[model samples]
Target: MELNNKKVKELLPQKEPFRFVDYVDDVDKNNKTIQCNYTFKSDNPIFLGHFPQEPIVPGVLLIEAMAQSAILLMLCIGNEISLDGEKYLLSKVEEVRFNKPLFPNQKANIISKIERSIPHFYFFSSKVYNGFEDKILEGKFIVFKK
Candidate 1:
C-alpha cells in the first residue's frame, strides 16, 4: 500500500520537527520491504547550528529516518502490529556507514527490509539515497515493539 503524508502522520508516532518520514512510496509485504521519502527542509533549525558556514544534515538524523521507515514497514506488513496503544523503540544500530553528506532541501529515499525478527524485536537493513540515487547511508538496526 502507498502511504501518503496524511496517512504517514496518522501512523507515525512522531510529531512535527521530529517526524522524518514524509510519505511511503511502496510497501511489499510479501518481500518484507518498504520504500519511503523525506525532504530535509532548508528552514530546519538544525541547519543553523550544525554548521554555521556549511550546514549539512546530521548523520544521526539519517539513521532516525531509517528507523522511522522501519517502524512504518512493521506496521504496514501483516505482522498484526498497531500503534493504537503500542510503542516502538529503536534498540540497536549496527554496521552503519555514511557515504555522502546531505544538504538542506535535499530529498532522500529511505529503503528498508526486514532481515529477521524475534518475538518482540525486529531486525532491519536500511539504506538512504539521495535524489540522484546515490547511497548516502546504510545500516542494520533493531526495533523493539512494546
Candidate 2:
C-alpha cells in the first residue's frame, strides 16, 4: 500500500522539521520491505551551517532519513507493535557508505527491508538513491523496541 504525507505524519513518531520521509512509494508486507521518497529543501535549517556556500545534504541526515523510513515500514505492518504506545530507538548503524553527495532541493528514494529480528532489535538493510539512480548511501541499522 502507498502512504501519503498526512498518513505518514500520523504513523511516524517524528514531527515536522525532523520527519524525513515524504511519501511511502510502496510497501510489501510479505517481504517486509518499503520504498520511500524524501526531498531536501534548500531552506532546511541544516544547510545554513553545513555549508552555506555549497549547501549539500549531510551524510548523517541521509542516514536519519533511511532509518526513519525503515521504522515507518515496520510500524505500519508489524502486528506486534502498537501504533500509539511502542517506542523505538536506533541502537546501531553499521557499514554505512556514502557514495554520492545530495544537494539541497534534491530528491532521493529510500529502499529498506528487514534483514533480521531478535528479541527486541530489528535489523534493516537500506539504500538511498537519487533520481538518476546514483546510490547516495547504503547501510544496516538496528532499532530496539523500548
Candidate 3:
C-alpha cells in the first residue's frame, strides 16, 4: 500500500520539524521492503547552525528517515504487528556510510529492506538516494519494538 503524508503522519509518532518522511511511495509486505522520500525545506532550523553558509541535512536525520521507513514497512507486514499500543526505538546502527551531503530543498529517496528480525528487534538494510540516483548514505539499522 502507498502511504501518503497524512497516512504516514497517522502511523508515525513524530511531528513536523522532526518527521523526516514526507511520503511512502511503495510498500512490499511479501519482500519486507519499502521505498519512501523526504524533501528538505530551505527554512529548516537545522540549517541555521549546521552552517548558514552551506547548510546540509545532518546524517543523523537521514538515519531517522530510514528508520521511519523501516517502521512503516514493518507495520504493513500485517495487522498482527501493527502499532496498536507500542513504541519503536532505534537500538543500533552499523556500517553506516555517508557518500554525499543533502542540501536544503533537495529530496531524498529512501529504500529500506528488512534483513532479519529477532523476537523484539528488526534489522534493516537501508539506503538513501538523491534525485540523480546517487547514493547519499547506506547503513544497517536495528529497531526494537516494545
Tens digits of per-residue lDDT for model 3, 39-126: 9889888899998898999999999999988888888885653588888999999999999998888899999999899899999999
- Arranged by TM-score with the best first, the candidates are 1, 3, 2
Q: Model 1 RMSD to the real structure?
A: 1.1
lDDT of 1 by residue, 70-93 (tens): 989989985664687888999999
Q: Arrange candidates by lDDT, descending.
A: 1, 3, 2
**Between 1 and 2, whose lDDT is larger?**
1
**Please, what is the TM-score per model?**
0.96, 0.95, 0.96
True-structure lDDT of candidate 1: 0.93
TM-score winner between 1 and 3, please give it: 1
Candidate 3 error regions (>4 Å): 80-82
Displacement of the residue 7 alpha carbon in candidate 1, Å = 0.5
Better of 2 and 3 by lDDT: 3
Strongest candidate by TM-score: 1
